[model samples]
Target: MPSPRPDVHPPVVTGIGVASGLGHGKDAFRQGLFEGRSVFALLARPGRQRGDGSPPFFGVEMPDPPSILPPRVERTAGLSGRAAVAVLDEAWREAGLDRVAPERIGLIVGGTNLMAREQFLSLRDYAERLDFLPPRHGHVFLDTDICGLCASQFPIRGFAHTIGAASASGAAAIVAAAEAVSSGRVDACIALGALQDVSALDLQGFRALGALGAGPVCRPMDRGHDGFLYGEACAALVVTRPELAGGTIYGRVLGAGFCADGCRGPEPNSDGQVRAAQDALADAGLAAADIDYVNAHATGTPSGDDAELETLRRLNLGHARVNATKSIIGHGLSAAGAVEAAAVLIQMREGLLHPVLHLETPLDEGFGWVRGGMAEHRIRHALKFSFGFGGSNIALVFGAPEGAAA
Candidate 1:
C-alpha cells in the first residue's frame, strides 16, 4: 500500500449551492447580484411585545422550498431543515462526492440562533399533553439537529459537528471544516449553513435593539444605512484540498480568522475586526495590498457599517474594491457568511464586481467601492467579512483560480 500524501495546502471550495430569497441556485443568485435586487418584504409573523400590537417588520423568505426532497428526510427536517438538505444535496452532486471515500469525509452545519419553526410546531402538537416523549413526537428543535440528518443521508463516517456562533456560525463551520482537511483529519467535507425565518423572539429583540432596518430596503455602506433586513437562506460548499477538487473550482479558501467584539449592546468597534482581517491576511501569507476586493459585513446597520469602514481604513487596504451584497439579498443571519462567500467566488469567476444597492451616499472617501453597477475586473484575492451579535467577527480570504489575474 502507498502512503497518503495528506495535502499540504489550504482547502478550496469546489462546489456551492444556495437556497435564498435571491433565488434557489447559484445562477439565480448571480443574476440577483448583477441586477441589485432587494428581496426585503414585510415579515409575515407579527412582532410580539414590540409596543405596537403588530410592529412593522422586514424579512426575506426562501424564494422557493425544496420541491424534490427525500420523503423521510423532508418530514424529519421540516422547512428550515429541508432548505439545508436542498443546498447540501446540490453541493454533494456538484462536487461529485460519490467518488470520495466515505470514511474520509466529514460534515459541519452552522446556525446562529435558529429554532426551526416546523420542528417546534410539530413537537408542540404531539407532546403538549404528555409529560415526556409522545407517540408521534418529532425531532427536537435544536440548531445541531440538521447535522446528524445530513450525515446520515451522506453516510459520512469521518466526523460531524454543528456550530452555533450566532451570525458567524456559518463561517465558523467552513473554517473548522477547512482546518480539519488541512490538518489531515479528513480528505473532504461539506460545510452547510441555513437560517430559517425569524422567530417572534428574535424580531422583538432586534426591534428592541433597533437593529432591524425600518425601511423595506437595505442600503449597506451608505451614510443613510440604518440596519439590516432579515432573510431566510441556506448555503453549502464542498471543501477539499486543491489536488482533490473534482468539479469547476470556484475559488480557494486560503485563510480565515475570527475575533470577539468586547462592546456592549448594539455597539460595534473596529479593533477586533481589524485583528481578524489582519490574521487572515497573515495566514494567507499576504498583505493588505494583496486583497483585490472585499465583501464587507456591512449589514446596513449604522454602527456595524461604521465599524467595518473604520477597520478597513485602519488596515489601509488600498487595492481592495469593497462591496456589500446584503443590499440586495438581505442579511441571512447564520447563513450570511456562506452566502456572501458564494457571491465572492461568483464575482471572481465572472471577472466582475457586483454593485451595492441604494448606496447613494458613500460613508467614507478613504476606501474604494463598487457602486452604481457591476464593474468588469478580475479578482485575484478577495476578503469576506461576517459579524454577528455579541461582537463575533470572522474574516475569510479567498484566491482566484490559478493563472487568473489579480
Candidate 2:
C-alpha cells in the first residue's frame, strides 16, 4: 500500500467483495439486485457438509469454496473465517494489488459472534464424533478474536480493530477505517463483518429474548410482520485513494457518523437516527437534499421499521429514494451494514436502485417503499443506514467522484 495523500480525497473504495445472504462478489450481488432475487430463506436443518469445523452452520447459499483456501484452513477455521477469506480473495483479485505492499494495508473487522468457542462446544454436543477440542496449547487466537483472524489472513501493518455492536459493528468498522486513512496513517484498509447463523445456542439466545420470527419469512413494514429472520454473512471492501482506483468504481464513501440512544434490546429512537443521518451529511459537507437514496436499517421488526421510517421521513430531504435490502437477505446482524453498503455501491455504478422486496404495506408519508425487481434512478449520492440492538446507529454517505457521470 502507498502512503495516504492528505491533499487528496483521503480514501476511495476501488474494489469491493461481499459474501452475504444475497451472494458473493460485486457482479453476483448486482445481478441478484437486478434480478430481484431474495436470498433470505429458512436454514437447512441438516443441509450441507461441514466444509470446515464440526458444528454445522447456516448462512446464505454460497458457491463452491475458492481454491485459495487450504483444506486444513477450511477444516479448522469454521464459517466466519471462510467467509472472510472469500471476500478478501475476490477483493484482492479484483483490485489487482500485485504491487501494493501488504504491510501498508490495514484491517478493521467487526463481529458479535466470530466463530465463538461455544459454537465448537455446541457442535461437540450434536456430533457423536469430535475432531477438535478447545485447545489447551495456550494459543492466543481464540474463536472470539475476530481481529486476529483478519490480521493474520491479510497481514496488514496498520491498526486492526474489531467492534461488537451487534448489528451495527460492520458500519462502525468502515467508519473507523475511513478515519484511519484520512489521517494519513495508512494507504488502504479492509473492513469486514461476518457471523455463523445456524448456531443453536445463538438461536436459542435470541428466542430467549423473544426476538425470533414466528413465521418463515421476514416481512419488513408488512401488516403481518412478525420479527427478524436471523442470517449470516461477511462483507469486505478495498478502501484506497480515489486516484489509484481501477475497475468499475461503484461509489466513494464520503463520510460516516455513529451515535447511541442509550436504550436496550432492539429499541430505536427516531430522533437519534435522524441526528445520526444529519451528522453524516454535515461531515460530508452535504445536505439532506444532496442524498439521492437511503438504504434503511429496517430489520422487518415492527418497531425497528417504524422508527427508521419516522427518522427517514423527518429528515425531509427533497426527493430521496428509500429501499431496504433486508427484505431480500433477511437481517444479517453485523454484516448487514457492509452488505447493504456494498449494494448501494453497485446500484450507484449500474445507475439503478434495487427495490425493497416483499414491501406490501405503504410506509408513512414521505417514506415510500420500493417494489419490483429494479428501479432506474440517476443517483449521485446515497446514504446507507444501520441501527443496532442497543440503539447504536450509523449513517454512511457514498457518492461518485465529483466530475463522474451519475
TM-score winner among the candidates? Answer: 1
Off by over 4 Å in 1: 1-8, 45-53, 119-138, 263-265
Q: Scored by CA lDDT, what does every candidate get? A: 0.78, 0.70
- Judged by lDDT, which candidate is best? 1
lDDT of 1 by residue, 1-406 (tens): 1113322366888888888887788888888888877777876642222445675777677655656566755655556667777788888888888888989999888784465454344455657655665432344366666776677677688987787667777888888888888878999888887765566666667867888888678888888888888877789988988889986888888778788778545677688888888778777777888888999988988888988888998888755798887888788888888888888998999999899888998888667788879889889989998887777778898898776663
Worst 10 residues of 1 by lDDT: 1-10
- Identify the runs in model 2 with alpha carbons over 4 angstroms from their true place: 1-10, 45-64, 116-123, 126-146, 196-198
All candidates' TM-scores?
0.91, 0.87
Shift in Å, residue 335, candidate 2 = 0.8
Candidate 2 clashing pairs, residues 3+ apart or interchain: 1-101
* lDDT by residue (tens digit), candidate 2, 83-195: 77788778766776544677678777776655544454556664764454445313323444556655666656666767767899888878877777677677777777665
